[model samples]
Target: MGTMAELFAGLLEGVSEAVAESTSLQGNHLLELAVPDDAWRQVLCVTYRLERRADVPANSFRLSAQASTPLPFLVQVMTEDQQLINQVDFNGGPPAAAISGSLTSYNGQILHIRMSLDGNPLVFHLDLGQPASAALSGRLLAFTLASRPLPATPENEQWPRSVTRQAFVLGYEDPVTGQITPPCRTMPPALSSSRVRQAFLDLTNLGIRSPKVFPLLSVPTDGAAAQAFRDALGNVDTDAVVAEMHQGRQLTATRTGSGAYTFRFVPDARYTGPRLLLVETYQLTSVPLSYGPGRVIKTFTLLPGERTTMRVSSYRRSSQSIQSTSSVLDSTSDESEREFEQAVTAEQGNSAESSKSFEYNAQASASAKGSWGWGSASASVSGGISGSNSSARQEFAKNLTSAVGKNAARASARREVTVDTSMDMKLEEGEESAVERTIENINTSRTLNFLFRQMNQEYAAVLHLVDVRVAFFSGHSESREEVPLAELDSLLDRVLNVPRTAEVRRQILDLVGATRDLTGNTHPGFVRTQAPDGTELAPAVDPTYTSDYTTPDGRTITLPGIVTAAERHVMRTDGVTVDAFLGEGQGLDAYSTGLQEQALRAQAADNLLKEREADRLQIALEIARDGDQKRAEAFRTLFMPTQIVNQIDHAAVNTAPVNGKPSS
Candidate 1:
């Protein structure tokens, strides 16, 4: 059993060659047309029964047809002017149309005729064995039947077969454009029915059962060489000495139970060492035979019970681009102690502090001399003695005593009325005050603008900071006072009670705040408020916003949508060809990104497998060649037996005597 396409193609295999020979012998010029020669044969065969007959008129033939099928069939008919005629539906046989006419030859291959179909006169032209347009313009009539599975049979033991309707086209022109389409040969036909196609499949199941080869070790039954070989074998584990060889081609070895082994031993026989062996190999392959357009037969041979595998193929070229990306991130940190120190330094400026102090001291001293006072007392005593002279007689004696007493009294009474006074005073006062502050300036306008403009969607909206200001102030203030004499309230009060004491008092003051004036030289009435270091305005809508609008069809348009559409349009315009854009076709849903990714992965896997297979085959070939070389080298190194050595010397003689005669 075979597919309908295969049967028809095989039946018309030699028709083109036959027609060519006939036309050449007749010495006629062939006409180029749109229909294939095999197409003509297929149509003629299914539509009518053809046979060689001498009774027919020269270069003429009658037309008639009766076609049927067990399964549903589709029939279509078109006139020469592209008008459809009778179209029979599948599941019902076509009504037999009574057609009688004589084919009149217009050229070597082009033949025309007027047939009476039902009642109308229809014209038909057949271009035999000539080039045709991709789509034939002449009348087209075809019958198609669904494929049916074949019954069980020995020929299909390994692979099943099915019978399908043959594939053929009478016209090649597009019905709408009246232009020729691509050749039908580019399309895949029904499955093949050839037996050779299953060879690879059968090989997968076939195993190498008990492959044998000549003994690796051959020597005398009983000798030192044989004993040595035996001892070597005894020392090694027999199971461990496994030899596994993989070859790409068939291996040659002695068949099991084929014949007896042979050997001969003589004295001083050198043992043969281990060596590799090489064998020439062969394989079975396929060769394709193409008889006509869309007709191919692959010739091959396979083992018993193996059948061909049907294959269908369609080829097309398509390409796309894939993108892959890699990303990385880096993070860094500093010690917390260092960060704290920096913050403290920035907040508090390092500067000298303020101080104030007050000090006061006083001292008084007095001294007197008594020498003048003693002299005055002596004069008073003398006056007192003169007043007492009235009593003269006793006065002389009293005068002496009085003189002594007056002298003592004078010395004692000489009290000096001298007085002296001195005073010393010291006063000290000090005051100090200071104000320290820090101001920091920073700008981030560029970074904010870049983020708003570049990192959003393709058609992002305008964004910016508005009415935003940042200010920081760090300050430090210190005041110091020393009052060691504060406990001396009475002295302090006495000193402070003076008229200039209040005016001489020390006062220190410190003020810490944010001030625009770096120098205190400014007037006290001057305003401290100053202009900001920087300002940021609100963001306005981008000009591209106007491009977004509503369509007349009521579809709302957005900036992002517009941008996406523009990009997609550009990509498609650049990637697609003009012909492809203008030509008719189905949507490219089948070639989506997901499908493309899967296909690429599969292709990569296939390539890797192919490379591995190639490497394995190469290694096998090298092993085979090395085996052969090693065998030859081993034989060269072997020492010949004494008998063979002596024979070689005798044979080397120029003129050796044989049977008492000189032999040349």
Candidate 2:
């Protein structure tokens, strides 16, 4: 009865064959099937031939199927004892049977069959159509039981379908190496619902029946490439290999009947040398249609019971080889270093050249000097005589003795001297012109005034020997040895032992106090004093007493007791007049009155000058204030257009002459 039903179902199979042959299922493809009878079984068969075409890459094609019928009355291909064998279906109007098993006799094609009913057993079979490679053979077996049935009705009649997906084991023999390379198998979609129970059942069936030939491809095993495949798998088992070609790295393994069997490999081909091999698989399941802002798409990933594939190709590292290609880097660095050194040397050479030029100019100017020479022989003799005191005096005396004789001689000599001096002056002027031309490059005021100030300050402590005063003295008659008043001991005692002036003492005390504030000590040694040379000034003697002394300008200065009492006096005695006729008091009174009058006149002049200056300033200030007021008025007038309009309106209102009512 099952065989007849199978035949009848096969005859009633729809045109899905043409659809499957033409269209490729990428994600989930939806199809609807009708059950003529509620109790009748419906079977679906999906067979696909996976071919390696020159255009299509490896592991590019796959096949899977599903049904939308109840499970109990499902039309399927199974045995009478409820054990699935080949192709069969339940009694229905046409006994719809799907011929969906393996297309390739070996592992080259895949077939997936699904049965939908309230309660039904799915059956499947394969037709290679032609003899296939012996290495490409696979089998279909059933081990897991189908799910139990539930009550069904016309409204809720459909039951999730059962599917059987099979992957054929196809192989090819290398002509040279004589090693067989297994054919690629399509991967299965990760199963989410129990409707795909038949698909996994199919896989286990094939694996158990033919453990040696069936291959499970999985992600690559190499640590580097494995992550990529694992990521591709997403949430799938990374350690398991699903399916692969024969001559490839083990991707995943499965225990069929007893022992574990490899299901896939990385490189699918066995090569004497090296070759790239790829194994691919995929999983198909009904994914809920997801809707976003604008579009809807069916998303999928490599999952268990789903189809996935892996590929391996020949590879080599080129980074290291490329790095080693350039060997002259050190030589390039050395050349760069040499260039840098040359640049530095050139800069230094230029600097030295500039310095040398300045030095050469300075030396050339220093080698030249300006000088003046005596003009005439008489002038030279006079200068010599003037330099000798006795000759100068004798000459003056002789001239005084013969005044007329000297005057006549002088007149004649003056004429000759004037002529000779004029000629000699011309000669000297010519010499001076030559000297000016020679020494024209010299800097006359190159020394800055600030630099002179610094030099003076620096040398203030150095006393010139010529400026030092020496005192001469004789000892008492009782003493046999003559004593020099300017002895070194006496000089040291007078100069060094002298007490500081009151001002100096106050400065010292202030310095000491400042030092103590900073260093927490009042010791004199801690006080810092500076000399002209920026050196610390050491006290020549201990500070014993402080006194004040007047400066040379008669300011009534004060100093310590040890300060010398040397009053500075100018020679005003020569200017003192001898008024022998006037009494002392009268002379003094006259001088005082004269000084007072002069002072009063000077004060009056100063007051008049100040008054005139004030008047001038006041006039200028008044003129400026008037000008400012005029400018301010002009500015106001310039910006008073609105104000003028308002004023016109006021005038028009106030000065409006009544047209007919005005009377005197």
After TM-score superposition, what is the CA distance of residue 9 in candidate 2 from its true location, in Å? 87
Candidate 1, residues 214-330, lDDT tens digits: the string is: 112222244543444334334432222221211111111111111222222111111111110100010101111222112121222222232233221111111101100000000
Question: After best superposition, candidate 2 residue 8: deviation in angstroms?
Answer: 91
Q: How many clashes in each structure?
A: 19, 86
lDDT of 1 at 417: 17
Question: TM-score of every model?
Answer: 0.13, 0.14
In candidate 2, position 301 carries an lDDT of: 24
CA shift of 495, model 1, Å: 99
Pairing residues by index, what is the TM-score of model 1?
A: 0.13
Instruction: Write one digit per residue (lDDT tens) for candidate 2, span 185-289.
Output: 222211112212333333443322122222333323455444444333343332333322222332333221111222333332121211000000111111111
